[model samples]
Structures are given as structure tokens and as C-alpha cells.
Target: MSTEKIKAELRTEFGKGAARRIRREHKIPAVVYGHGNEPIHLTLPGHDTMMAIKHGGANALLELDIDGDAQLALTKQVQVDPVRRVLEHVDFVAVKRGEKVTVDVPVVTVGDAAPETLVVTENATVQVEAEATHIPEQFEISVEGAEAGTQFLASQIELPSGTTLLTDAETLVVNVTAAPTAEALEAELEEAEAEAGIEKDEPEAASDEAAEDGDSE
Candidate 1:
């Protein structure tokens, strides 16, 4: 992926209080590490970083301009407040062009399977290694007009140039199955109600109880 240039400021203060102060200033505290170098503490523009991540995937190319020096990095991890939806901290990993990196790419299913057939995903993401600058955001699998009982495996997925699949070839990706009908839904509902100790509708329930009586008779 092409690097997105984002300016960041060096952070000297390090602590919970300092982090909170940085956030109050609408900045995101982050650290860049990798290549056997000491981690650098920095602050990024909160809104811009959030927007970049929203547009780019987690392995977003970050062209960081820190204190007049340019650095290429990728977002390694992001800590967010579960309730507030605010970014707490982020970790960036420095990378060099042409270097290979392993990261999980999301799986995106395209096209529709056969009518009355449902595409069930067994794996949501796959691990792969590729050039840092050419990492794929996701893998797209097409199941257009596939019949029921169709299954897709990881080895069957096509990888982008310079990308190699790190996941096992035997890993299941997607499977096609028959869609549940109204009668199937009713049966499932009845089973769920029985499991939850809920009363079923009267006439149908009476028939089941009578079946027991007839068996005993």
C-alpha cells in the first residue's frame, strides 16, 4: 500500500497523566519501534490518524514526519477505549521498502452463491507475507452461482503479486449450504423454546403431548 503522509510530534513526557493530557489536546500517543532501534515516543493528530485507519486498513502506510525527519511505518496495534470510542495509544513498526512482513489480511467474499444456498465463512482472515509497500488489504473470493455443498479452502485463494499465503492450505475459507426454510425455522424455534423452558403454542404442543400418551397407550 502507498504510504499516507501524516505529521507527528515527538513526545517527551511518558505516563498515564501525560497520555491523558495528550488526548485532551486531541493528539494520539504512539511509539515507533523495530529494526533494532530504540522506541520513539510521539504524538499523532487524533482525528487524522483515526480517519486514515478508517480509510486504510490496520496495516496502513504511515509516512510520519517527526521533528523534521521522515520515517516509514505501519500501525501495529491500536488501543481504544471500549466505551468512549477514543484512541488510547498506538504502536507503529518501522519498515523498509522491498522488505517482507507478515500480517493478517481480511477475507472479502464477492458475488453471490447459487440461489437458496448460503455462503458460510469458516475463516474471516488469513495470514500472509508480502512486500511492505504492496501488502493486500483483503482477499476477495467469488462464489457466483455456486451450488450447495461447495467449499473453498485457503489454498484456493489467489494472492496478489509478491504476497505468499502463510495460512495452511487445508484451512477452510467458505462453504455453501442450503438455506433454511420456514419449516426449518419453526423446528429450530421449537427446539430453542424447549431448551429455554418456554411454553410452545397450544395445538402443536398438545399434539406432542398426545404423541407421548399414544406411545404409552
Candidate 2:
């Protein structure tokens, strides 16, 4: 990952009203805290920040130009409006170049497993320690032609240069299993329905015959 430069301004106001005001101006309310220093409140350009983070992957390393002074920061938390889909708030931790940071990087699987096999990702992300500016976007594990019962553990992942795995070595990350056939699926569904006391409807031939006889009379 590369450091992205974004312009930021000091935020003097506080409270929900102030945050709303900042958003109305197409800016984002954020705070930077780290290294045992006082938290610095800031307002960042909404569109620029969004683009920078989007391209930077999960944990974006940014060089915030606050009033002409540059500070390297890493994205720690982000809050967005669920309905409006707009950024509501962001939190950053100040970091210096060459500093190592612990972060959870996404685990991605490449290629498909063997035919008629089901692929399940048990742990989608694994914790790693790496340089702040050189953090990897994701870790990819190849599952091509993998047989059933084959399991990939965190220890099996190939780490990037200068990256250390923090997750447990024995933790299961991906598992390949045989896919259930249609008959097997139906049987399981029936078993579930029986356990739930759901009786399947059946045709009542005797009752229908009695109704026919009464109608004839």
C-alpha cells in the first residue's frame, strides 16, 4: 500500500450539530489520536477522502496535510449512515513511517475447488503485523484442484515480505468438503420437517368417496 496525501483542516466545533454542519459542506468529521498525544479534531474533504480510502484497501495509510504540516495516519474506524450511505465520522491513528502496525487483512481464495466440492471460508480475515505504508491489501490462497477434506490453516498462508502473521497457526481459515447430492438435500429437508412436526398433506380418498355418495343421494 502507498501513502495517499489528503488535505485536512482543524475542527473547532463539536457535537452532532457541528458534525452535520461539516457534512453539509461536503466534508467529514474525523479525529487523529496515537503515540500518547492529544487527539486532534479535523475536517477532511469527503469525496477526496472517500476515493483515497477506497483505493487504499481496508486499512488505508494516509498523509494528512493539516494546515501545511504533514502527519501520517492510518484509518482505524469509520462510521457511515446506513440509509444515506454517506460517511458520518472517521477515526485515525497517527503513525510514522517504518512503524509496524497490527491489522486484520482480508483472506481471499483464488480459483475454484475440485468439481462437486463445497468451499467454505471459516475465517475471512487474519491478523498480521506489517509496516504501515506497505500493508498488503489481501492474502490470497489458491484452492484450484483441491480435494475434499483439504483444509487450509493460517499457518499455510504465504506472507508478504516484511509481514508477520499474528493469528494462531492452527486456526482453520478455509475448508473443502464434498457437496451434498440432490437426494441427500431432500432427505435432510424431510428430516428437518419431521423434527418440526410438520406433516405433509396427503389426499383423502375415503373422504372424497363419501362426499360423492352423499351428493348422488
Candidate 2 residue spans exceeding 4 A from truth: 191-200, 203-217
TM-score of 2: 0.90
**Candidate 1 local Cα displacement, residue 205, angstroms:** 10
Query: Which portions of model 1 show Cα errors greater than 4 Å?
Result: 199-217
How far off is residue 129 in model 2, in Å?
0.8
lDDT of 2 by residue, 1-217 (tens): 8888999999999999999999999999999999999999999999999988888878988899999999999998989889988888889999998999999999999998999999999999999999988899999999999999999999999998999999999999999999999999999999999999999866699779889999999
What CA root-mean-square deviation does each model show from the true structure? 4.2, 2.8
Task: Write one digit per residue (lDDT tens) for candidate 1, span 129-168.
Answer: 9998898888899999999999999999999778999999
